[model samples]
Target: KFPGVPRVERVSFNKGPLELVRHTHMASLGDAAHFEVDYVDMPAGFNDPDLSLEGGISGLTHALEAQGARVLTKEKVVRGSCEGRDTTLFLPHPPRKEGFVEGRAFGSGQRYYFLMFVGEEDGPQLREMARTFMESFAVTDGCTAQPAPTPAPSSPTVVSVVEGTHDAATGWRKIENTELGFGVLMPGAARHESEQAQVEPFPITHHTYINEDDAGVYAAEVFGEYPPNFHNTPGSYETMLDVTLYAMKRNFEPSGFTITPLRDLKAGTFPGREFTVTNEKLGAQGRTQIYVTAKYIYVFTAFTRGQAAASAANALERFFSSVRITTK
Candidate 1:
């Protein structure tokens, strides 16, 4: 299925009455993408052949909804059944929602759930991947885990060439730009990039600052300014927050890290969300935070390699909390 930079992983687990088996596949940098298909078996005693799966949240549907809330946006769902098994599919926006389609099967003794996630990039192939998965979803009377597939031949990896241009002196320092009307704390010199977003009819400038930690890992603080009073529009602030967070994820993804949003990030006027970042190849893990202002949006995130979450956690919290926006 993975024609480009083919790499895939599979794992299975059984926890008393709960069983989960997942298959993860990865592609190369340019066409970088992640696709995972999950099979879940739970001990839920639901006995009703004519039950309405979409009537209300209960049993398998209830559990499916809970998981959907985490991975998918709070959008309306497509309801029906797959192979006579009641199903609820969550079609979240790509790149942001990371391509999650959730469903479940109702049966006595042991119920089943099917979930497929595709992220990083989207195209016709990914849609086909989803279609094929759902078309094959069903309840297996005697399902068993398959042996791990043999590893494919190694291939060359692609890395980012964007290097830090900030020549400021070393040591943790406060980065400020009065012209831009914002300041932030950065571990070291940060690379800067500016470009016009690919938009039809109209386009806006986008700016990003990326800095590196002592461990050779990198962190980014991205900000983009829009037209006058653009943030005044209804839901403008929320839109900026969501778009900024998604941009930050795309920024880190090229380096082989996976990101997942955990919340909507709202408290009064606070305009940002929290995210978890992981890199299985490097064993690095940490969180992401980004705050949006009236006319400016920013994202600052970092992760530590082979260490506890403490190092990256402190930096991330400090970096995000220390932001001061004059325009806000």
Candidate 2:
């Protein structure tokens, strides 16, 4: 069990001859935050001595970035000859009151990913918790030397809402919303709503589209004046992009979601950032795209869970591919 985190529950998964542990604490409060520790088996052929600890971490960072995550900081910690890599990542949408932090380590022939969150004011305490957890961790070589069984498939319950005629072959319809300045192909009736939101020093308009059924939920948010600090200069726009991304990160923190690194993305002619996040507790996963134009920021998000998540692959592909940004 990890120190300082009470009531830790240990869960395990089997991958062929290898077994991994996932330690979780579902209920925590105050300076203490939600914490989890994952032990992963190194893939076969990954035991290369020439692959220095830093190189391994760099590879991991690159993989994360490829998946649309942004790495905030990375450092090396020496625990004797067993060198470990520590990294911090930004969440996609952080909570309003608290910040999210994920501390990961790989060394001693073992890989571990630790998750903990802190209030904006509890940075020091969060670091202490991470240090304590890392210091107390130990790697074990315990596994049944046998191939694991193939898991059975799951039957998912999906509910979808659709209006108007659907194509017999594709089961979808085209949707064009001129007010939102975008068009997409969807599987259901898209509900649109507008709200006023405070994005730092300015009040912005938010247009949202909601389409959900048992299968999954597809949402797109068009944020008016997203980077409230944009000044038209190259440097200023870059700063505004950072600020906007930070705000998005904060929005996702409350759900305890793990985000992939942010990667360069393009929405038609507009270049932007994209990433995906998974919330195990909610049994849901999402892909998000953030695009900023001269006047607004556009966020496209798709969410699904369980069987629906896996089975809706085709629909999701068509929906995203059909997205056309009509605003300048």
Candidate 3:
């Protein structure tokens, strides 16, 4: 947001290698009040291994120095509970300016950069504003994290391996329907169930693979060859996924249910949605992610007895990541 800068312009371009969106908010009068955020996805092999927090900070320092800017200070700090570096830069150009830079690294070669530039570094008001802005930064929605359970989850991390792998600690095994062209990794002991439906538009079938432990339940459902029109309509994939979610939301039996929509997700490159549902009628709570591949839709759900089953969180994450869909 540009402060009192009435004319703010936004430009988005999908063609270039740089970031897709940019807000050109800084004033050419050199007032020095500037704040900008950007994301960079550094591919794994692109000068990384050095693409992490420390490496990023070091790189920024060098780039700033090349522009006649002297680095005033650099220190490692935990801002917003994320590991990052805080650096102050002094640029002695025609428009003398000083700025602060904060950089945070996300896994899989992603990085978030926060930059604030101002006319003078000695101004207490400007320094206070920059400090507050950097310290308050947070990742929400897709990256917002829920608090850990008081006792922590019993299986906070499920290190599962695909079938035929030599490791026994891989608590999961792979299940594939070659005919269906999809493969999934499920808890080692899950079994399959399928039924054909005599519905309108033909070839409709329902498949479910499920298993339960004393503490929880894990299940995946497949909706094969659903109504063709449903998939053919524009935006139908998301619409149909929403419809499925609605069906899950409304069926709480005798009582109403509470639903929390989590972040949207992708299975490999396929689109998906993730959410949690509470079936008040059954006193059950679960997290589910559903993905689609042309003719087949996959729904993975992991649930336990109550509202906060931390133990199932990792399992749900793993289940979503395990999906492999080849149809298109």
Using Cα atoms with residue i matched to residue i, what is each candidate's TM-score against the true structure? 0.43, 0.46, 0.43
Which ranges in model 2 have alpha carbons more than 4 Å from their true place?
1-169, 198-203, 225-229, 235-238, 308-310
Q: Which window of 10 residues has the lowest lDDT sum in candidate 2?
A: 142-151
Which candidate should be chosen as best, given TM-score against the real structure?
Answer: 2
| lDDT of prediction 2 | 0.56
Cα lDDT over the full model 3: 0.56
Which residue runs does candidate 1 get wrong by more than 4 Å? 1-171, 198-200, 213-220, 231-233, 246-256, 262-270
Candidate lDDT (C-alpha), each: 0.49, 0.56, 0.56
Residue 253 local lDDT, model 1: 88
Could you give candidate 2's per-residue lDDT for residues 1-328 as a string of tens digits?
4445466577775422344466655334554455555444444333432233444355445544554457788786555444566666543434443343555554444343443433233366766765665576544542222223222234332333334346465677655666557766667777767665432233456777778776677777777753422343333333334445555666787768776755877655555776776778877776777776666777777767775644656656766776778754
